[model samples]
Target chain A: MQTKRMTFSSRWLPYALLAPQVLITVVFFIWPASQALWQSMLRQDAFGLRTTFVWFRNFERLFDNPLYLASMKTTAIFAISTTLLAMSLSLLFAVMVNRMLRSREWYTTFLVWPYAVAPAIAGVLWWFMFNTSVGIVPYMLEGFGYDWNHRLDGNDAMILVVLAAAWKQISYNFLFFLAGLQSIPQSLLEAAAIDGAGRTKRFWTIVFPLLSPTTFFLMVVNVVYAMFDTFGVIHATTEGGPAQATNILVYNVFRDGFVNGNLGASAAQSVVLMGIVVVLTVVQFRFIERRVNY
Target chain B: MVENDRFGSLLAHLILILGVAAVVFPVYVAVIASTHAPGTFLQGVMPLLPGSHAIENYRTVIFEGRAQAGAPPIGLMLWNSFVMAMMIAVGKIAISLLSAFAIVYFRFRFRIFFFWVIFLTLMLPVEVRIVPTYAVVANLGLLNSYAGLSIPLIASATATFLFRQFFMTVPEEMLEAARVDGAGPMKFFKDILLPLSITNIAAMFVIMFIYGWNQYLWPLLVTNDERYYTVVMGIQRMVTGGDSEPLWHLVMATVVMAALPPILVILFMQRLFVKGLVETEK
Candidate 1:
């Protein structure tokens, strides 16, 4: 908050430094975002190449489309299930690693390895493991005479996608949670133990509350990631196929825009997705900001 | 601590070991699978040890022309990915460093507004902007060009935000001393700031490189021709272009080869990766 009076030369310096970034952001980021907004309100003309202003007609059509409606539902389910699963597994793993006095580094390194793999590759790996013919798990299941079809069943596909996402994300959340866990003072835990509180009570009363801020932060990140960044997995694994069982909002946007060339519809879907993310983020911050203590 | 406390500690270790195994087993399987022959891999036999066929698989993916025989050349795809990743990495780091330095070191009007604008971009994922982004790329006539893939992603708000945060923690005395020594802004940054920020820069570079390398949808959408495909894009083409049985061996082989660079980087600089994440969280 300290004001440093700047000479004319120095005053222009920061702007000069910011010139490249501003230019790129405007040309790429801001321009694209605005273009998407503009496309959402327009309708394609007879040639399919020309466009006319429709003024919310695309949004209306989106509402009427059953596939779009189903995708919205699928997105919510995917986001919530993946977020919850990733958060819980991350916390459990973080706690396990934090409690270890020896071999902690090895455990920590092993935990973070999954985060390095590309999402596309992760999807491919999971696809192989879940494939009915070549997959080891499916082979073993069939050996026992049980039928399994992840690609065909909607619920099974959702679970598989969520599991794939949660597996990749656990490392990212675990790193943050482990850092948070280490930062908590040990004397408090020692005092809790000296008071004869059992491990569960001590954890609930002392550790859990102390770790709430990290949990809340990870929750916001994990949810956003589940919603937006899981597109690669969904695209590679399902292609939103088997009756669009795995078509989340982002994947739907990709399919509609590039695959189907319904630019207007895709833009409308994107705006809707952006609105949902913004609202969820705002609600999360409002709820958690008050509870987070420095 | 009591004997019961020691017992609880042992139990915690047991749990941690099991968790580590769960996290690592899949990767282990993938690595072992990479070394097995095509028939063995397809049959789903357990290869508990590394086979002698890793070189064969690598040769098949990289030079033997087995991964995607008729698609874009594998060598060309690797070159494309490497060049694109390097360009984006350099561009992201330079822009981020400059913007961060401007925000943190220099006095500027509308600083907070600029900061917020950059930070807000982080929330808007690429999916939300892909339609317009595709339009912009098409408009620029950059479609299928390396510039088209690299330029849009170069201005990373996340990198700028991170560098700004890191820059703010540097002591003011260092800057004042550099100024007193008759160094200009550029000179001060080159001599003082850049050297001191090596670790942070390296961390950001690795992260941005991985990000650029791993990008799928943007490249897939923006580039129509197979010639411009990155490694991930190439892998996707392999998976989808076939009507015959899914070539698990070739697919996994390509995957393992694609994953090699990042995995090696992670192995050597594992500490830096952990530190970067911790710093970001703070």
Candidate 2:
């Protein structure tokens, strides 16, 4: 909210400067979002001819519908699992890499490039590796007498999508964790070591606790990511298939809106997603404000 | 130094090696897969090592796309992706810089309103409001065009906030000095601000370029025409477009190409990428 004290008093120039961003936001972002809210309340007849304004009908039916409810539960699970898997793995890698003296940058270079790979591409790569027919993972799993088929088995499909999603996210989480780990003062750890703490003990007592702020921040980010951004991960590989096992909310919004052409229902879903995003954004900004104070 | 635990250092190296291998495994497999002939993927587990047909497979995908799958050649899709990425990156940065400068340097009417409007965009990612947004673009007849591919995605709150944050850190003396020198706001911005912001701009360019290149669903929705198909979305089409199992060799080749540019960007400009990413979060 703060601006420079010595400010320029401009009439048309500031307005002109702000025009392009404001125009795009209103036309592309705000107007469409408002339309989504409006349309969520209106339902069209099967023939696509007559439309009726049904108050809360779409949202009511969505909650009552078993599939929508299942999709909500599926999204919760997928988001949580992906966040945990990605954060923990990256935390471990960050911790290990943080300890290295000579090879730290080398290891980081190897781990961080995957952040550049598209989620959809990441999904495809994993899908190929776990391909039911000839994928390497399935072949390796077959050695343990486990039949790996994502097409038919819902659990297999969920696991496959999670791996793909988590795999793509690891690099992002790794970078943040590395930065966070690097920021921690070495003096504290050395003090703990002087108290006869073992490395494991020191990590639990000193390192992990110190990294909590970063952990909490990454948790929110990874959750938002798994919820929204992993649309590609689901779309490219699973297509919300095997009885909609991996159909996260964002993908469902896309499938219901664009693919199935259920406008009212999809609009309602979009509104719901917007509400979730609003909450998440508020939480993120609130945490950021708190961090700034710290 | 902490306790000199030789065993601990050894364990750290061992763990890091495994972690690196795990991180690189999928792409390594993709590269190895791209090198093989089509027949190699049909019968058994994917081979771990590189194959002899790398050139042929890369050539096939780059030049001659699988017509049956309806995917365009990789060469064209890669160009499309590059153009889209550049537009989104440069457009977002330019507009954001202007708007941030406006907000920071000038006290105008409805300034807070405009800041909040830009802030609202963070909550409305394309995924949430895809249907209505697509309708708006379609109404404007932007479908299957580069403008459609990038413009809708270019209005960025993160970039604006980044510039705003950076602008606040800039010493006020620069502005006062320029004002005393009779240089107007625009002149001062172009002369002083832009030069000072080059590093932040470069860092943001790295991040946004990757974000734009990695886009999948938006491109998938707007472009039914093959000409506008980006490599990221094009890979999805190659996998699911054909009835028969995808030509793994060529598909993997395209995958390598699609993921290469952004990966190389990060590898080469890692410091900038990290700075952009970490600062954007802040």
Candidate 3:
């Protein structure tokens, strides 16, 4: 192989090429993020006008309000349960599809097709299945002498939201898991089999550990998805209905800003949400970095 | 052992078949609902089969004044969505590809710092920045315009990150070969790099298109005028009437109509979609 050292002049070319991207990122992303930080300090009147800066007053209000605390609890439950459930189901489906010899392509294609659909549309579709009056699931339950109404009950509403969120996430996690499975060397599994290891043992000792990096990546991505990206569904299906049963943090932030026009409080809530996410992400990376082989 | 393998195969097929049905069933409901008449749908009874009323319902949605009060025509909303999505798709991909190409193909000072900046942007949700972004867009006089809707979303950290990963795996020898052939940077990117990265580009395009199509909050805030509403916004208006009962069938029909183009795209490009994701793992 012929090797040539990259010269100093060549290095500057890359930076010049990257200038447009950096400029856009600064304009759209970094600048807005900093502005959000600044907005967290100010107070707004009922008319949606910023009045003055009252440092930590917004944060104080956030801690003082019972609804805000309940929303935090709701968000935690929603995020953790959905992420774990979605990841497990996707992993199982990916394994089954990977091991299948016949109709594998057909199964894989059909399974991943849902991920391509818009989240807003998925919310609409799922609402069709969960609606008390017209939904199939409720109708079926009634047929079986069981009553189910997501709109009337808080717990039922939470379960419905979690299920809807997790369903949309399964195909995303499955794609990553399938990709991870394909990248693993078959020789390692063969070696385990030759050593008289059972299928379950081989998976536990070899496949699971090797798949950790992918799993960790999926964990971070899934948490973020459950936390922030689920606004469309919450807006569509429940609209934080049955007395705010399905009101996750992002939905709360949105409702405050757009619905009630409390821009300052909403901005403060968003700042707190961002703070939690940043802390969780940092902790996740810190833990995963130690375990990640690559 | 052969018997055991056969039993396992049967089990796998059974599981996958059930999973596929669950995945496809809701979409089936949406399609069926779209075809049903308003009177039939209001009866709170769903048919297992498609109806002949799809054309009628669609005509009502499009031709009739089905828009929310203070909202634009449905056709205009769809047009807004299409134009905004296309612009965002093209802009995002161009920025991502160029940035990825730079990071992978060249060395520079503060490279790692730039990389981290990109990664950090992914963690900052739109909720965090909406207040500031709203002000920024207002200040720039981009309110109620296609440029206002599209420009703020022109850069995406996820696309850039994905493309960078893809670019890292491109063979260095190909670039060196092009250089030795006396190809300049522009020729090298145009002829050698872009051609080799076509699949990745297509994959990124589909992903970005979906992202732009589904955007709601930013557009909702920045573009107050009904003329700039996207399809998602239009659907939301139909579903949420204050005192009047929402037309469920019409809403589902609009939802289904909005979803059709993307579904068709996915169906035709299924292989590329899977291939794109698979390559990301490498």
Q: Kindly give the stretch of ten consecutive residues in candidate 2 chain B with the minimal lDDT sum.
A: B64-73
Which lDDT values do the candidates have, in the order given?
0.79, 0.92, 0.77
Cα lDDT of model 3 by residue, A81-141, tens digit: 8899899989989988988776777877788767756666677778778777777888888
Candidate 3 lDDT, tens digit per residue, B210-280? 67877876776787676787877677767765556567667777787677766666678877766655554
lDDT of 1 by residue, B38-125 (tens): 7775555345577778887677777655434445546777788888888998999998899888887776688777776676666577
Best candidate, DockQ? 2
Per-prediction DockQ comes to: 0.56, 0.88, 0.49
Q: Candidate 1: where are CA atoms >4 Å away?
A: A1-11, A143-145, A280-293, B1-7, B41-52, B66-70
Per-residue C-alpha lDDT of model 1 across residues A1-294, encoded as one tens digit per residue: 332333113868888888888888888877788788888999987578777999999999999999989988898898899989888888887887777767788888878877877788788777777777766667777879967688688877887788788888888988888888888898898888888887789778988998888788788888888888888889888787678888888998888887788888999998898787778667676765576545
The better-scoring model by TM-score among 2 and 3 is 2
Model 2, docking class? high
What's the residue-level lDDT of A87 in candidate 2?
90
Candidate 2, residues B182-218: lDDT per residue as tens digits? 9998999999999999999999999999999999989
**Whole-model lDDT, model 3:** 0.77
Clashes of each: 0, 0, 0
Residue B96, model 2: lDDT of: 100
Give the number of the best model, judged by lDDT: 2
